[model samples]
Target chain A: MQWWTLFQKELIENVRNVKWVWVPLVMILLAVMDPLTNYYLPQIIDAAGGMPDDTEIQLPEYQPADVVMMSLGQFSSMGVLVIALMSMGVISGERKSGVSELILVKPVSYLNYITAKWASLALLTLVAFSLGMLASWYYINLLFGALSFGALLQVLLFYGLWLLLIVSISIFYNTLVKTPGLVAFLTIATVMLMGLVTTIFSHILEWSPNRISTYIQQMLTTGSVPSDLTGAAIVTLMMIVFLIFGSVYTFRKKELAS
Target chain B: MALVTVEKLSKKYDSSPAVSQTSFQLTSGKCVALIGPNGAGKTTTLRMLSGLLKPTSGTIAFAGMSQNSDIRNSIGYLPQHPVFFKWMTGKEFLVYVSRLAYLSKPEALRRAKNLLERVGLAESANRRISKYSGGMKQRLGIAQAMIHQPMLLMLDEPVSSLDPIGRRDVLTLMEELKEDMTILFSTHILGDADEVSDEVLLMHEGKIIESGSMGELRQKYQTAKIKLGFDGDLRDYQEKVTALPTVIECYIQRDVLHVTVQNMTAARHDILTAASSEEWPLTSFAVNRASLEDMFMKAVNS
Candidate 1:
């Protein structure tokens, strides 16, 4: 009940700050804009490039699944960056603002506090990302042909797991670092490095948590789950669990000086 | 009668001690002031007692609870600069902290209203905390601390940041609150301690130098001296005053005679009688009593 109350406060804070409105707007804009711009790229190019007579420009046809994949790509880079920046101050901001001192001095459990934070961020991530992807799906079906809804759903489930991983990385770093700026920098840098390292070593690193990203795109493009999806999903799930516990453990020390 | 007992309580940051082996006991329903200069570890000791900071060593047993037993539910703490969610209304913030203190929602709401009224903020309960003045914020801080009706209410410099009027408002509040719960507050100003505290824990250099009731402390350290100002040559009365059996020593400086006396009652009688009989020109006579500041200076200097 206490954790629920605290979680309610977090959600109210998100509402008051307009994070609920603005974050999903940014995400949906990133998702749908990619497809709309791609569909009109030829016209945009022809207008900009005023050829003297007849100029033939060859542009590749965009499939609905491919455009959705392109939107996911934008999410992977820009969406992940936005999530990292937005959630970077989850723990550190409270500590710096001295609100944690007021609450922690009560008989509240450190684990419950951490879980409440993670759960709220997870809810926000789920809502915003789902709405953003649905908007992107609408535009893709409208401009490009209709894609498989079942495929999009499966891809969202996997990619939602991936977004969960990113949000956990953010909160986990929030617990470790005191400055929100440092938390954002470190979380995005670590996630990007994990993505880079996993791509270079995918042949050997089948179990890397970063593989969930590729699994997300692969699941979206092809209608079948990859054979290695179970191993990567398990590894990523274990990491999320570890990050939650790690957050709880590290957050215990935050009140030592606060 | 001891509500809180702390023994050898110490807290260190890195290798340097902030509160060094401090021991003290707070009697039930007594307002105990932790008085010290800046960097004297009063804040550190209060933080450890309130469970905001863990002590590097020592024990704090509240209401006879053993070490390691959680005393958070029984103690209320207001930090030196109490921080609140600026977005929350005063009543809402109180309700929120009351819930954290384990009150049910309905009970929290009731107590939130009750406390806001008690703190004289019922009219402004719906105003956001960002709009509260320094004094109002401190009052709201105290209301939140007391929402659960804890046995001990700990305030860290509750009035240190307020304007004169704000300071008076909080001090008056503290004076009324001590009737219900034990209050352990910290301040560098000895005058505030003298005004509201029944007992004082005086700290210097992170160590407790003196701890006693206000009356007992004054009795122990009170100086027996009198100041005499004369209209005539002050030297004329110095010798005559020192000759009295109660007069232990006498000296004149700047037209005033300072006399150390063995007894105030006896000295007052002898000096007045001699002045009347001898027709000595005596202008004023006053017996000096040592103040908390004097005692603090004496302790710090020693």
Candidate 2:
């Protein structure tokens, strides 16, 4: 119950957070952006009711869920943005404010402090992801065509996968450093590595799961979970591995000083 | 019973020791003040005792609990500088802090209200702490600390940021709280410690060099010198006054005279009678006792 109070307080703080306001605001904006991308984009390129491409104007064959994938791209970008800003202060602000000393004297555990952060960030990702999903279905049905329920489910699944990646990365940021600026920088660097650098790394390192999330994004857009499911499973496991190691490494040795 | 016991505690960053082999014990219903110069380990000691830092060596026992986590449950700490989330309102900050201190739902809300009111922050409870004055923030620190009614309350330089009125308000609260809990606070200011401490622990070079009840310490380091002020020039009767068998020393301050007799009780009457027989029109006379601040300064300097 005490742990829950701390968690709830973190939620309220995040909700009231000026930065927190941007989270939902941006996500909802992405929500608004999803349909806008589906609607005006084709018309803008065509100008004469037909888009100008090398061959002809086509939206690269959107799956019933491709609308969702585009929406995922929008929301994921927002997630990365919000958590990046949030990650900067994971432990740094507390050190500055001396709240660490205030909380330490309470029969509060190091686990409590770490756990509160984990819970708070996890909740933020969950709520934002859920909001994105709702927006994804509404946009696709309204702008694209008749509902493809299977594709709808696949898009929702991708939202989960993407959120898992972001949460893991954010927690890693929280533990590895003390300052918010460093946290933001680390998060951006890690994302770039996972999204882009991993492609190069994977070629040299044969068993790298680094580019797996990008592949998952590809599969979700096509409305297929993929044949083996082995690669995706391994990649998910790797994220957990990174999260466990990162969480244990930094949090275990973190000096609870204010 | 000792509410807090520190043994051979030390903290060092790189090669310099911030606090070294500091040891002390505090019991319920008593207020012990830690007085020291800046970087004398007062804040470090308080932080360690509050479970904020890991000591380089040794142990701290709080209400029979050796673990910091256990100690934290029973103690309330007011840090030297208090920072709120800035985004949170005063009520929100207290709600969060109160909950962290383990107050239940209604109880947390209730405690937050009561503590805010106690600190005279009820009107500003909805205001953001970033808008609060320095004194108001200090008051908030105290209010948040007392929300759970912790058995042991520790404050580190709490009054350093407060005005005289604010300082007086906090000291009066501490005096009122003495009946039920143990308090151990640290400060560098001599007058602050002199007013609230039942006992004083003097720290220097990261070590507790001297400690005792204020009276015990004052008498232990009694000075032979006494303050004496006369209606006329003391030099006129200096020889005669010094000739009195009971008078050991005297010094004049302004218009009042203070005489220190060799034996205060036995020679007090004789000293006065001698003055009367001499036809000296003495305006005032009293025993001059040593002050805690004087003893503290001397101990630290020595």
Candidate 3:
């Protein structure tokens, strides 16, 4: 019940700050723009008027699933950064403003406090990402061809986990730091470092949570789940659980100092 | 009826101790002022008692609780500079905090309404807290703290940041509140402490140097004195006042002659008789008692 109350405050704050509006808007714009830009690329290049008259540029044909994948690709970079930026101040900003001191003095536990934040951010990420992916799926079918709904659902479930992992990382750093900007920077840096290591040693790091993106891409195009998909998903879930517990622990120690 | 007892409560930040070996007891239904100058660890002691900051070494025992039970349910705390969710309305903020204290929604709303009215914030209850004046926000902060109906309400520097009028308003509110529950408020301003608190705990250099009822502290540090103000220069009467047999020491400070005397009655009779006989200009004559400022200075410096 206490967690529910805290969650309501968090959700209300997100609504008041227009995170509900702009976060989803940004996601939809990125998702829809991918399909729109790809469909009109040849004309866009022609309209630039920089190419010679005899130049013949042959663009590759884009399947419906490929356009969706490209949209997720945009999300992988810009969208992940947006989630980090949105959630970076969840705990640290409250502490800095001294509101956390007042709230924590009540009969509220650290676990409830941390989980309320995580749940609120996760809810926003789920709704915003679902709307973005649905809009992209609609555009993909309209501009290109028909795509299976089951494939889109699979893509959403897998990729949504990756987005939630970013949210957890952002919240974890918020508990460790005083400045929201530092939290954002640290979260982004951690995600990028994980991606870099996974890419450099793909064979050795096949069990990494970063491999969820690869499984996402494979599901989008080939309609077949990779053998390591469950392993990567489970690892990602475990990492999220660990980050949450770490957040609760760190928050208990650092709350007074902040 | 002792409400809370703290023993050997200490807090060390890094290597320096912020609060050291502070021991005190709070009886039920009294306003106790934690009095000290800045950096005297008043805020540190309040925070540890409020459960906002953990003490380095000590034990705080409430009257009816077990050793390791959560004591926060019985305490409400307001920080010196309280920052709320500026986006929340005054009413909404109170209700939100009450809910965190484990009240059901209906009970939360009911208490929020009652508190807003009690604090004279009913009209502005629907307004966003960001739009509140400093005093109004302070009233709201107090309301939120009391929403849970804690037995002990601790405020750190409650009236130090307000204008004269706002200070009076909060002081009046605090006066009304002390009738019901125990209040422990910290202040560096001696006048506020003197006017409002029943007992005072004086802290200096991380240690509580003095703690007592107002009358007891005054009696212990009282110095019998008389102040004389003349229409003309004080230096003229300064010599005459010093020559009186009852006067121990006569000094001029800010155009007034402060005469420390051996006996209050003898000094008054002697000075008045001398002034009348010599036809000296005496604009004001006051029999003075030692103020809280003097007591605070002596306690802190001692």
Model number with the top TM-score: 3
Query: Candidate 1 - CAPRI tier?
Result: medium
Tell me the lDDT of model 2 at B222: 79
> Once superposed on the true structure, which residue ranges of model 2 sit more than 4 Å away at CA?
A18-20, A28-79, A203-213, A217-223, A227-230, A241-249, B66-69, B87-92, B123-127, B224-288
DockQ for each candidate? 0.62, 0.53, 0.74
DockQ of candidate 2 is 0.53
Query: Model-by-model lDDT, in order?
Result: 0.86, 0.72, 0.90
Q: For residues A69-132, write the lDDT of model 3, one tens digit per residue.
A: 8888889899989998899888899888899888889989889999999999999998999999
TM-score of each: 0.93, 0.82, 0.97
lDDT value, candidate 3, whole model: 0.90
Each candidate's chain B TM-score? 0.88, 0.83, 0.95
Error of 1 at A34 (Å): 1.3
- Candidates 1 and 3 compared by DockQ, better number: 3
Query: What fraction of the correct interface contacts does each predicted structure contain?
Result: 0.59, 0.86, 0.81
For model 1, how does the per-residue alpha-carbon lDDT over B249-290 read when each residue is reduced to its tens digit?
Answer: 898877779888888898889888988998877788888887
Ranking by TM-score: 3, 1, 2
